[model samples]
Target: MLQTEFPFTLPCGYVDARGNLHRQGTMRLATALDEIEPLQDARVRANEAYLTILVLSRVVTRLGDLHPVDVRVIEGLFSADLAYLQRLYVQINEVGTTLFETQCPRCGLRFSLDLTEGGDINDASAGL
Candidate 1:
């Protein structure tokens, strides 16, 4: 079965009006409508960058104690958290998996690296 939702922890997290920090969240795979509807949103029409906010709001089903996360919540997120989610969105939707296959040149050993842990292919020391 295809995985439709992915869980994540924000690096900086969202701080609610009550001053509570929400770090954990779940983002479901976006539907065609999820991508299309946002394009028609006035906010996105005004500022193309706002598309990220709308798209994220629709796909994120839960966040910490919050359910049905919305644009207001996504807008309140720290920049780091927004960036984190954007990368995650691309990783899961575009790349299709967090596990990256790589090989050790010397030993010819193959291994899978978890991209969610901030792994970088350019950083040779990664996963060592």
Candidate 2:
């Protein structure tokens, strides 16, 4: 089955107006509509940047103590944090569950790694 939920930490983090820092969160995999629906928003048409804001808002289920993640939270993210989310979105939606697989040259044992949680084998912690 396709893994649906993904966890991540922001590079710079999002600081709310209350001064609370939101660094960790869970982002669910985007469906076709999750990506396509934003293109129809007037704000997205007016300012292309809002497309990502909307898309991220829809996929991010939680961030730190914040409940019911919203567009306001996405709009408040730092540029670095935004970039991290964008990368993660692509990684989850495009690259997918199996990041890579190989067989040990010496032992000849095959193994595969699933990155749907937070990261791939390249950087299991994927602090990016």
Question: In terms of TM-score, which candidate is strongest?
Answer: 1
lDDT of 1 by residue, 1-128 (tens): 77788777776789999999998789898888989998998888899999999999999999999999989999999999899788777766885466534455577554546666576454324543
Give candidate 1 misplaced runs (Cα > 4 Å).
95-128
Q: Cα RMSD (Å) between model 2 and the true structure?
A: 8.0
Estimate, for each residue in 1-128, the C-alpha lDDT of model 2 and write its tens digit. Answer: 86688766676777888888987788998888998999999999999988999999999999999977999888888888898788778777885335533334577444445545764455334432
Model 2 TM-score, 2 decimals: 0.74
- Taking every candidate in turn, the Cα RMSD to the unseen true structure, in Å, is 7.7, 8.0
Candidate 2, pairs of clashing residues? none
Per-residue error at 89 for model 1, in Å? 0.4
